[model samples]
Target: MTIHHHPSNETLATYAAGTLDLGRRLVVASHLDRCDACRKAVRGFEQVAGTMLEDLPPTTMSADALARTLARIDGLGADESRRASFREDFEPGLPACLRRYELGRWRWIGPGVEMRSIVVPGANDVRVFLLKGAPGTRLPQHSHSGTELTLILDGAYAHEGGRFGAGDFEEADESVEHRPIVSDDEACICLVALEGRLKLSGFMGALLNPFVRL
Candidate 1:
């Protein structure tokens, strides 16, 4: 019921610019659903973008550029309704709604890490990946080649950006190698949208390489 952590400025900018992939967008949208502050920021960014577009000098563009821009906007609207409906159907955990998600049953991967990934509908390279981190444990250091979004469904994660609790949204940049310490009493459950595989760092991470596919 209280205000939670907001998305980074970079994330708000990317979402406004319409360059974020579907997987990541879902995370942002999910958080936006719960965080009013971030929802307002995203809206402000959109208004700024609209103003910038309106300010552009009238110039004839190559037909291709116009088509490409419109196509991108259209793509953004495709599943807005479906995703909104799906998200609205239930709270974060509901057996019936999860059965419709198609993410594999929860699979344990280590002493403290367990997850399942769901392929986003109509998306080719994007996937909705879930992770449950046991309390007092730290997630491995990993970096992404593309954008990644994380929404805390329950518990929390402490990283460079700071603590993120339930309803908090995080968008990790390409340059950020993320390492999050999980809360102690409850498992840190998160919904992440990853565009591609992750690159793990350090010795232990290397040892866990095969099993730690992002």
Candidate 2:
């Protein structure tokens, strides 16, 4: 599939530097697994980071540090290696970065819409979840308190900005406010990492906001 959207360069740089939070990092990883261009961009950022590190002054380390590090590396199992890339065997009908996560039951949030919470370690303010919208489903019009990262896994959706098909990545913040409607061809499934609350608009959204946890 042709990917029409991607995380911003700042976000990719942060991801390459290992500074992004777990939830956001997982979202980017999911996109990287599907988009070759983003993967190349991230690799370039990593190379830049490596060069910067090389220019820094060296620090003293314990005489046995190398051995200890090597031992730790050797101790890592197949699962650890798999996490470094995509693992097809981990789970079915889910993104590679999310295969290891425990997906909660799908709960109806609105007409033709369902949501499944993803159980992530070190649970914080970030809300990580899966959203499936049946054909022709129109989601609530809303913005965000902070950042919102969404990765389309299956099918497609469209809003004012553009159409987002499978493997597309969308990033929005408080400045964005639009309703997404699923394509009529099939259901749309998206992996989402949301920080802060959903600032739903309109009277209907205001009424639902109190009841909706997302």
Candidate 3:
């Protein structure tokens, strides 16, 4: 799969530093699973962080800190085992990063467009979902109130930015306003993370916005 779009440098840096919110982090992780270039960039950022830490002045830790850390490390083994088992039973055709999420039933949002909410624990205001567009379908024209990250999982779509095929990651904000149309023969499926509510454009979109809840 050829990926023409990717998360911004700032986004990738925040992700590597563990500073991105859970919803956005999940979106970036899903993209990284398929984009080797972004994976390398994340590793580079991690290495830089490690080197910076090594250069910092030493600080004494609490007596129980080491014990607590060791205990947490031990617990991770069991947690990883459970995660491995879960991944083994994960649904086919979905990104590996989505294995841990609970997918809600798909609901029709517009003509040839369907969306399924992704149940993300502790995600209060943020929304995550799987959006599928049938071939030749044009998605609603809208802009976001905050950052939006979209990771293509199957097929392809095109917007003002460019054509996004499987494995492409598109990052948009309030400044962006474009309608995406699926271009592949098959349906286009993408994992989307929205930091804030969408601001629909046009009369039809505004009329249906309240009911759609995207």
Clashes (N, CA, C under 3 Å) per candidate: 0, 0, 0
- The list of candidate 3 runs beyond 4 A from truth reads 62-91
* Model 3 TM-score, 2 decimals: 0.88
Model 1 worst lDDT window (10 residues): 89-98
The candidate that achieves the highest TM-score relative to the unseen native structure: 3
TM-score (C-alpha) between model 2 and the true structure: 0.87
Ten contiguous residues with the weakest lDDT in model 2: 72-81
Q: Which candidate tops lDDT?
A: 2
Looking at model 3, the pairs that clash are none
CA lDDT, candidate 3, residue 165: 92
TM-score of each: 0.73, 0.87, 0.88
Question: What residue pairs clash in candidate 2, if any at all?
Answer: none
User: What is the RMSD, in Å, between candidate 2 and the native fold over all Cα?
Assistant: 3.8
| Tens-digit lDDT track of model 2 for 56-130 | 999998999889755543322234437645544433567655766776888988778899988888648888998
* lDDT (10s digit) by residue, model 1, range 15-60: 7677776667667766766777876887789889889989999888
Q: For all the candidates, what are their Cα RMSDs to the real structure? A: 4.9, 3.8, 3.3
Whole-model Cα lDDT of every candidate shown, in order: 0.72, 0.83, 0.82
